[model samples]
Target: MQQVVIIGAGMGGLAAALRLQAHGFDVTVLEKQPRPGGRSSVIEECGFRVDTGPTILVMKDAFEDTYRAIGENLNERVEFVRLDPNYRIYYHDDTHLDLYSDPAKLAEEVERVAPGSGAQLARFMADSAAKYALGMAFVERNYTQITDLANPVALRRLLQTRAYQNLYRQVARAFGGSDKLAKAFSFHSMFLGLSPFEALAMYSLITYADLALGMWYPLGGIYRIVEDMLHLAQQMGVTVRTNAPVEQICIEAGRVRGVRLASGEEVPADIVVSNADLPYTYRHLVAPEHRRSYPDARLERMDYACSGYLLYLGVDRTYPHLQHQALYFSEDYRANLDAIFRTRTLPDAPSFHLNVPTVTDPSLAPPGHSLLYVLAPMPNLTAGIDWEAAAPVVREKLLAQLERIVDPDIREHIVWERDYRPTDFLHDFNAAHGTAFGSLSHGFFQSAYFRPHNKAPDVDGLYFVGQGTYPGIGLPMVHISSRLVTERILEEWS
Candidate 1:
């Protein structure tokens, strides 16, 4: 049996460990942050339970595939509730739009907002569905590396999908030039850490995934899915040890042998699968001389996705009208995107996403209380802004924003509040430039093999997994990313 040491129990790390164990390999996962889930994770304080990352479960079928591959099913272990009014969008003009699971209802809503947009919305959905089919066939299933797409079929599909057309362009073309609608539809790039204007046309699949599948959530929180996966992995004999942060990927003669813990003890294994952030693995875990292309200078030039400033609050009272998910758009959308991605600076009036899971799942907060996750997408730490100084200002602005919509005394009801910023991402996940999602704007030069290789390009027995690698970010995509990387390793090592 092959002995594998997988680092970072984040979604990718855990998925890779589970897949390899199912392949009959000896797998032990080592995470840095005292537990699984690098960035998209959970936290508990004073009886307030917070998911802390990734409030929405966008694509769930992939999650089912993940568990099924391990001889179980996601639904059996975790109860997934389908959302009827999927999400509520709050425009700057104070107009609200609730996207429903039914296309007809959603179309009516769109028609209500933008008079002629109803027909445009229907056409957009049809086109996005076609893009989704093309995406599933030629894009999502396989790895994102150019080497994987080098196949003639992929090239043919490339002609079909036109991955380089730019998602923003497609949205603008299929629909009208309403910048607000464009920004709302194209905002999916944040999952990949890029602006809608900058992300690839392939990401149009997000629209398909959203309207086609609708949104979903676990009964407790998204963490329930993570707990289920960890349970299945343990049942499969995949060892999981928390509080054991992997300090180094022990390498010798260009081959990964094992990992060294933060405590300075090394455990030997046959291969090392890194579920940790890719840049961190390359820049810190591996020796510079053994690296192929990902040195500080090389990585420095790469665009990283926006890091976020988050405020997790547990309010002592309920605001019943708030939806499960809400996007509060800023008046200046393009400037906000440019500030975060193109220019790497903080914007004056930034758009924000608010997740009030307690609206749907009340168990997260104490009785009569609400849990709020306020996220403002900001430039990664490369912006040179001080998070210590920025977090409070952002928090106040967010409160002011929410107060306008909900109740004026919203802040007065706050029983507890904690903030997580780029600095936290850096300190906790060792994310390069304190990037939360991994890598930078998913652009022409940043997709597929261009992004980062699943297996170390130069190292003989090293592997990469998670959002930082091929298939790209999001909980579902990261699982797929790890499965592809580990499946290849199992095939080779077996």
Candidate 2:
């Protein structure tokens, strides 16, 4: 058996390990953190168990495919509760809208918010469905050359669906120029760390996937998926070692030798797969001379995704009125996005995501208590903002907004609180630019065939599996990335 060494036991890394091990490769997964799940880990304090990373799951078919690849059933392992009214969008005017998975219900909700928009929404979803079909054709494959993506048939479909248009404009035009509906739908691109105004219309595939396929949460929290993957990987004879940070990828004679741990131990292998932040792996783990395709200068020029300021609060009081997921859009949505993506500064009034997991699963916290996960998009570390000084002010702003939208007495009910900043992402995940989502913002050039390939162009036996590679960001995309990379490895190494 060919020995394989995988770095970072994240969702991508863990999933890749399982597939490789099931195929009869000897695999060892090394994680820097004490526990598995790099970004998809958990935090437990004061009787509160909160997921530290992704809160909800969408495009669940991608997840099901991963487990099925290893001859395991996903539903048999994790209990998932599909959320109704996927999200409650709180507008600046205090009027709210619920986004439901059922088409009739969603149409009703849209008409309630933007009168006469029900018909427009139907047309928009049809266009979005077409975009999803065209986009996924490229997303589900590995690109060996530009022709794989730029072929005539694909180009024709791209123009026909107008997938090349700007996302915000497409959604606005679809909804008869209703800014509220546009904001509600187009904001899905933000999860990929791209501003809707700048993202390509093809990304509406995300909006379609969210509404059509539905949003789901595993009963125990998002961490439950990670825990299940870890357990399954171990059962398959895959060795997983935590607290083993890889300091360098050892390459000699233009081939990967193995990895050098931070503790000075060398684990030799025939192949090495990295799930670390792509740019970080290239910049820190791989030596400069070996990075012909991604030199320091080129890496610096690459656009990174936006970071976020996160607050995980364990409240002593339950919010029965709160939906499982919610969002608050600032009055000036464009200005808010511009601050994060253009000027690279903190917004005066920020839009944020609110996740109340305890609303669906009371087990996440102690009896009579609830957990609040708040996230506000912010500029990446390139902004050079002093988070130490900015965090307190941001925290105050978030709490005040919560008081207004949820309850006036919310401030006094806190039992435990934790704040995560871009710097924390840097220190913990070695994420390039401390991006809270995945690194590498999804721009026209940074997506599809333009994204980094899984295999190294300069060094042999070196590969990458994660958001930094193609298929890009989100838990679902990362899962597909693992599958794609596994296929590449099997074809090449076989």
Give the winner by lDDT.
2
TM-score versus the correct structure, for each prediction: 0.95, 0.99
Model 2 agreement with the true structure over 182-243: per-residue lDDT tens digits: 99999999999999999999999999999998999999999999988988987899999999
Residue lDDT tens for model 1, 1-494: 88989888888888888888888889998877777877768988878889988887877887877788888867878887888677788888898887787988988887777678988888777767766766666435445344655566645656775756888887877668866567667777777787887778778778679868878989989888788778888788998888888877877887878889989989889888888778878888888888867778987787777888898988888887888888888877778888988887777777888888888889898899999898899898879998778877888888898898777898789899888898988898888888877754567566655667688878878888888777777888888787788777866786
Following a full C-alpha superposition, what root-mean-square deviation does model 2 have from the true structure?
0.9
Query: What would the TM-score be for candidate 1 when compared with the true structure?
Result: 0.95
- What does each candidate score in C-alpha RMSD? 2.0, 0.9
lDDT of each: 0.80, 0.93
Off by over 4 Å in 2: 151-153
In model 1, the clashing pairs are 144-448, 145-448, 145-449, 146-449, 303-440, 304-440, 305-440
